[model samples]
Target: MRMVWKTMRLRHVGMAFFWACSMLTFRSSILLTGEANTPELESIVVIVSFVANMTTLLALAAWAENDPERIDRLPLWPMAAVVVVGLVLVHFAGRVGGGALLPFLLGGAVLTGVGYGAFWGSWADCYGRMHPARTSFYVPVAFLLTAALFLAVSLLAENLSVPAIVLMVPLPVISLVCLVHCRAEVPDGRAVPEGGSKRSLLAVGSLIGLIVASLVLSCLFGFMWELTVFTVGSVNEAHLAPLVANLMVAVALVGLVLYARTRVNLDIAYRIVVPVIVVLFAVLPFFWETNPVALNIIMSASYGVFDVVIWSLVAATSYDFAVSGFVVGGIVRSLSVLLRLIGIGIGFLVTLVPGKPSALIVGVSLGALYVLVMLGLFNWLRHKRKAGAEKLEEGAQTDAFAQLDTSAPDEISETPGEEDAAPAAGAKSTDNTMPAASAKPTASAERADLDDEQALYTTIAEDYGLTRREAEVLPFLARGRSAKVIAEALFVSESTIRTHTRRILEKTDLHSKQQLIDLIENYE
Candidate 1:
């Protein structure tokens, strides 16, 4: 256990480091570009970013669903592809300065979009498949660490352009290294099964709902990113910008840690957190002109914390439904990614509207949408709970009958002297039966009766038929740890872990680590 914990801690540290580097690179580039003076250019850039991210998300969903095993097996080909394409397009677009470059830029957007889409989805699948149990802990830890690292890097890279870009280059390289280390882990196929049926349709609907929820949240976050950039430029005191952003990131990290330790329900977190986000964004415009600094700080903290929780929810939920294997899992994830892309496009369109307060309007609109979806999801979950209980009860009766048939011969073979013993045994069995029969019904009747803490976990287990060990390992996987780290921590050999992982995939019918992670992250 100690070893497992140690390995997990190390993995978390690595994730933080990688994320930090990525953030530093990304933020520095944005800062260098500065806020576009022209609304048209700003809109164009935002659209490009949105398109790039969306394309990447879609490709990721497909890859995770179809060829997940390749995630770790391959080097950072996809990452390299995205960066190379982006740089090339940016260079050519600058050089040509005409209609001809438009296609190139659009193509670049598609490349980056596809690359990142795959990257994010794959990352989720990998983590969920590898460390099913610790999805809540490791997933957030990895992201927080990355955010912190990136913030620090961004602070240092603010002044140096070449060095900053060069520093950023290491992120893809490091990601590649991690991928190499992950090769031995094997794919855990936990995607939901493919086929059209009432149950399948329900799964699809749930996936769509999740996607819609993500779309609203992503738009809000994207707007927040833009707001941060705008705030940095508008404020005269430049030094304060990074400080405020860092502080916000810190607060968010702390909140994530607290939530992980507490194992809070995603629903409860959404109920509490979404409202706060809405209120904060709604009031943000009031401060933008008068008290930008303080408002920026507060907004950063609120938005950052909300994002962390939201990402965790996404990871958890994805894993829950990923049990059907990659085909269904991929479709569900792809749809979600598509919705996010649509949301980004919508956000871009909103920016095109005439007004200085467009960002504010977008933020408020997103918040309102989030509230509505969250409320609907909460209500839907309540209904599912009732239905799930009824199903459990029905299942229990069937299980009892099957057991009785199988055991009848042994019972009848008992001698006359054993009749008394038989009755006692029968009485014991009856006692056990009553609870078994009542368990599902009771769980259905009361939401509190369900182990909501394990709602995501159990869902994945049921969907994929995961064994105890596989379920336990999933959370670590999501954290992006190497097999060695997992082995050391679990007090098992890497090969043992790999074997178990293979079984998990076979049982769940999934294709890749990213699919698994995405499933857990976005579990209903």
Candidate 2:
């Protein structure tokens, strides 16, 4: 029961169902329109092209992610509501008959894209802000659900009239449920702290670029699915495809969950899964006509893995060091969707060529793969360098810790000229081993009897704009440590500690170290 409770997240699962339903709602309209003429789905290409979802989608993604207002607080529900309305409008419009097709496609289809942009932008922000760690499981589960939804749309929409409209009812209903459940969110990992980070995504360099590039390439895989289904009009085979797809998604999710639970290194998974999937996507489709079911299984399995990795990256990027998760994650995910829409648009154009040439598909796939492979290698190399650098820093810190014991005194040698002074009138020096004549500094005037108070440190630090490093130093000051002791312990110079204390004093408007200590006690 504990394991189940730990692994199962209602919001994640519900969001998956919600997102799938949203997509299916939009797709149902296409199915309804395609049913009248073009039994083979040729005019469906016209629907996609005429709507031209990519331009607006790309624009919306850019606008939504970069939108300054969303940075401070995410308006998740309102955005989702917009998405629901957009998809529902498309659904209702799909029920419109032949003569009404032009107006509906011209108007409703774009609204559906608009709705998708709003929902995806906000949801992607949520993923980045709240679900960084859970990405491995929820992503695949959502995708698997999406596969199930697509399969349902393919099979049920064969009738493509009232039944299709009925099928869409659940899409918004599930989304509304998703909205309700999302009121409470599990705490997110790796988010930019409140008030935002010190640096921007551009400051983080190639990492963001790499994540965006990989996601765009993954869109090619999605494009191929659309291309084949629309061009071939193999709705029956496509309908059955999701069964194997969902199964593969389940298997992949299990492995990912195990990896998540066990805390295993994902390096090997990263090195292999993406590249292998890219190869399969490029090569397998040629044979899709011969073995449609097998092709679907492969596609499903690839999608399962790809979705997990993709979302994980998005979440991680959202929580990237020194940057706001909303801006980074939102932008990256939005770009991914925009690129995907563009890829699908390209696929639609490809099918327009005589006989629907396979070469163009292969060429596009390979080009995407090649770019991804190169970028993956680049990212891998950079990651290894970063890990090595962190290890070195930890090793250095460990050696510094080894040299000093927790209770050790700040040596008189640390303070030049201290040996010449006689004991203070009332106070006593800690090390009696020093000459009885050796001087003790009075409390307020000079002596900092070291006392590091950890608990009170955070409160004090926050009250004054202390950075994380400065906050760490605050606790050591509470223990009444001299600059020398604190510096040695922190592996820094006494001068640096003096600088920090000065800054803290400036921020707190305190007169001296003793005053700061007194102020800290009140907070404690």
Candidate 3:
């Protein structure tokens, strides 16, 4: 029992360590730029790294689409980690070689960027898959915890006699260990999926909007966290770095924890709190001139809110799609990498702004307004979709009753001729009466979609005469259970579960899990 518990916990611990290390590395951007005075070095490193990271992340998304394998076996993670090690080696080589740091800096940036792309992709894949139901809160919570830990370490190491390398050790070491373990346990690599109907077009659109909005917001956040907050005034950057990092992370954590205990209305929060945040941004110039601490507090609080809200959006959309862990993970992580790159570039540019209040205010206000506009678009799509679903449900109930009453030849009964077989010349109808299988579903079929997923699974499978193994797999499929999850529950290989799913689909004449879940709704 103890061993099992430890095994379950190892991945979480390893992820915590990796994310904390990542937070530290992000903070180090200021330190790196501060030390390396050459302008050319900064530009070269940022541009090259940004391109490399984006390419690698896109590649992961593409590869994940093709082969939904587990993180450790994906080859991407191992290669990225190796490049990171090379980055470290280059950093030292530069120290010893003592010449133009441009090549080394660019090399380090590319390597580091590639590494981060893989690292985040894997983390997103694991966490998103394991906790699909709770990922909205979990992803942000994970970030909050890691940020806090990163801050604590920075503070302690500032005064302690520990070597610098110790700070960097956890990211690479713990992450590798976790990936290896994940590989061994889930060798098949597909995520256990949560079952559901196909998402509405509006729901999908909202998600795409979210991805775009988040990328923009992340860029602004990157600018602020990296350099803007620290440079607000003539204060101690080193001391302030850890303090602000802790503040942002702590406040975000506390806020999220509190929100978790309540029914956090996304629309309500956005309507109220976001305006206040916009107000703060409007007045950032004044705060920068007066109390940097106060400005930092406001910024930190906004970041905290951003952490919860953005992650929640991702989680909610993933639920809508009923996506596999690998697919969603790849999507989410790839966006994160791109956004971070944007943020870093934006933040770096913000640092170059002349020490004038007007320019700062303009930049900040523009960013806030842009975010607000994007958010409005996102909410509009979400609410519209939700309204459409509610309407569809009402229509479904109405149609069910109408179908039960009319007894059209198409709306066949559970036992078609059992009751109404009095001297009628007609061909026998199947127990389940879906229109002969086609790509385009009928209007009546659309009205039969259901929300009670488990019931749907049983109804469809029994009506179609599924084998017992297929019967066992059916409920999980109706629930949109991933191949990995179904495999584990049945104590079988993922390949076996996949085979069962294929047969079930074939026998039922259902094209996909989403269709199966929808199939039963047309009746009850």
Candidate 4:
């Protein structure tokens, strides 16, 4: 058990390391491309694009909720078809550049949105069902890896456009493949007969709250992206590249590290991270007129941290919601994205108003908005928790404990039975009572509870049928730790970690780290 625990911890660390590296590379490349030419145009385009993406994502989320098993079984080809259509539109948009292109742009935007949205939604749903805890960890790791990849690509872009793009595509594709591999491990709802009465498709109140929360978060992101563009564009060359790169890398690394080190409950992390993000945003205006280099870097790091936290929480929570409400989870996720797009539109419109507020003012206002939204979400989550607890208590009082007692043969036979039953009853009573009777003290009960928790973990581990090493590796994969970090932690080589990961995939029947995460979140 100790070895197993150690291995798992090592795996977690390694996953974090590798993912961080990748993100750093990827984000750096994006920064190099300098996509934020016209603030208004960029914001508008992104808003439209995100809306489209979010809608498709939401649909995918819904599909996962309703039919995760089917999702697992299906190949990526169908989904790839959607992506191809979007890419084709993008190609056409590149060709037709005039007032006549508005409709085409809109069409392209929707396609892009749907294509990515479907994949994103499905990814979240898959992660929730397969590797829930890892979902949070890997998110940061992925960001870190993307950042790293961005930086690497940026440096090499002049000479290696084709190679860079090829490399970039593989990361997500590999992630997708991991999901495919883990399909068998995903819990099938069909195995457990549905017992509830037919009910409304939507959980209206919860869904509304989620959408609102998503909108606020999305707006926060959109605003931050705009700020980044503004700052980077305004800054001088000597200071710009290093500052942006550092900020991107720092944020990813910090988020990854913090997430790995912390063991807070997912809900608690959500509450904490959201408030911090808002506070950071609120203060952004103070530095707006300062050296563009310094301000941009700081804000980027802060936003980076915020993004990691928010995405992790969303990924985890959405999975939980999906399990409880199936189809509704997807709709809620999509609605959340839509809300975000709406917020972006509002922000863009606000910016269009003459005398646009300084970054700090915009940041502060958005920060305040974030706080308000978070408060609302906190309340909602609190209520959900309370309700769940109450239900569990009720269940314990009515059925669970009684079932436990009834499972004892001695208790059953003692009621009233034949002469032959006497010996059997005596034996049954002895067998049933010995373990419980021996475990009588407070400490014993505590230990028993710990044992129970371990048992639960073990049971979950068994469901994945991971070897002790593979189980250890599972969390690391979720955390997005690098192979090197994992190796160092495990006191093994990086190649060993890779080998373990390969076997882990085979054992769990998962294809990607994301799929493993989905399984953990949903079934565990």
Model 2 stretches with alpha carbons more than 4 Å out? 1-9, 25-95, 144-162, 184-213, 234-239, 258-271, 285-289, 292-297, 320-326, 352-360, 380-524
Point out the worst 10-residue segment of candidate 3 by lDDT.
431-440
354-397 in candidate 1: lDDT tens per residue? 66764556466655666666767886897899999999998997
lDDT of 4 by residue, 1-524 (tens): 22222333222322233233223221232222222223434344455766676665555544544344555554664554554454344334434656534565456456645655555544544444433445545565556654555455445644564433344434444544554543334433121113211221423344454345444655555454454545454212322364355546546455544545432244444445555655665665666556434434544454455445544554445443434322444555556556556544554454556664565456546655755666677887998999999999887765754555455445544655433443443433435454333332434467787696565555555444343445555667766788888888866678878887777777667898788667666664
Q: RMSD for each model, in Å, please?
A: 10.3, 11.0, 9.8, 11.4
Better of 1 and 4 by lDDT: 1
Error of 4 at 182 (Å): 4.1
Query: Who wins the TM-score comparison?
Result: 3
What's model 3's overall lDDT?
A: 0.54
Give all TM-scores, in the order shown. 0.62, 0.62, 0.65, 0.59
Candidate 1 to truth, TM: 0.62
Q: On a 0 to 100 scale, what is the lDDT of residue 215 in model 2?
A: 65
Model 2 lDDT, residue 269, Cα: 65
Q: Which ten residues in a row are the worst by lDDT in model 2?
A: 436-445
Candidate 4 colliding pairs, count: 78
Misplaced by over 4 Å in model 1 are 1-4, 9-43, 63-76, 84-110, 160-162, 186-211, 223-267, 291-303, 314-374, 377-418, 423-498, 501-524
